[model samples]
Target: MSLLINIQYMPYVLAAIVVILITFRLWKWKRSLNYWRDRNVSGPTPVLYFGNTLTALFKPFVYTEMEWYKKYGRIYGVYGLVRPALTVAEPALVKQILVKEFHKFRNRMPETD
Candidate 1:
């Protein structure tokens, strides 16, 4: 009967919806991550939904900065959400990027406006 068809497909329909939502979320996360990767020097693989860090939100680990340097060298990127942070080598590069010409990269983030 028609009832049998609907009942049999109910689980499949729910599974499909869940799959779609998970896929969408992953796609968005990757897109945001890639924006930094393209500009970054390079680094290790990012954890799924966890990112390149194991640190909690808004909390900087005592040796987190050193960890990045030790693992990825003085040049690499750490991503959390939309942040595209770069850990640069060469103090001159830092001066050039941060102080000498701060205006060129004023905001730590990009805005849609």
Candidate 2:
């Protein structure tokens, strides 16, 4: 009898769990969308899950990048599947990051035999 009651409540528990998971995912997506905006970076808007990936699907990657460069200027942010990425078009900034900031961006790989 106790087992029968547990089985009857199982579906409700499963449904509640699913609803919670969906809500969390949507909240995370919304938060991720605001990442660059919070930092005052400007760029194209992204869709819920696809981000700017769908743009690249229909257009050549290089042309898409060029369009963004022209529209957003020397610095912009883009989303690669909900992950925000910064693009620096200015040569001087790139040089600064590569040379002056090399320590901050050093590769972190574990040594192995």
| Best candidate (score: TM-score) | 2
Runs of candidate 2 exceeding 4 Å displacement:
105-113
Residue-pair clashes per prediction, in order, are 0, 0
lDDT to native, each model: 0.72, 0.90
Per-residue lDDT over 2-102 for candidate 2, one digit per residue giving the tens place of the 0 to 100 score: 99999999999999999999999999998998899999999999998888899999989899999999999999999988988888899999899779997
lDDT of 1 by residue, 2-97 (tens): 999999999999999999999998888877777656775677556666676656445676467666678887678776644556668768888888
Cα RMSD for candidates in order: 5.5, 4.6
The lDDT, on a scale of 0 to 1, for candidate 2 is: 0.90
- Candidate 2 — worst ten consecutive residues by lDDT sum? 104-113
For each candidate, what TM-score against the reference? Answer: 0.59, 0.86
lDDT score for residue 9 of model 1: 100
Error of 1 at 81 (Å): 4.2
Model 2 TM-score, 2 decimals = 0.86
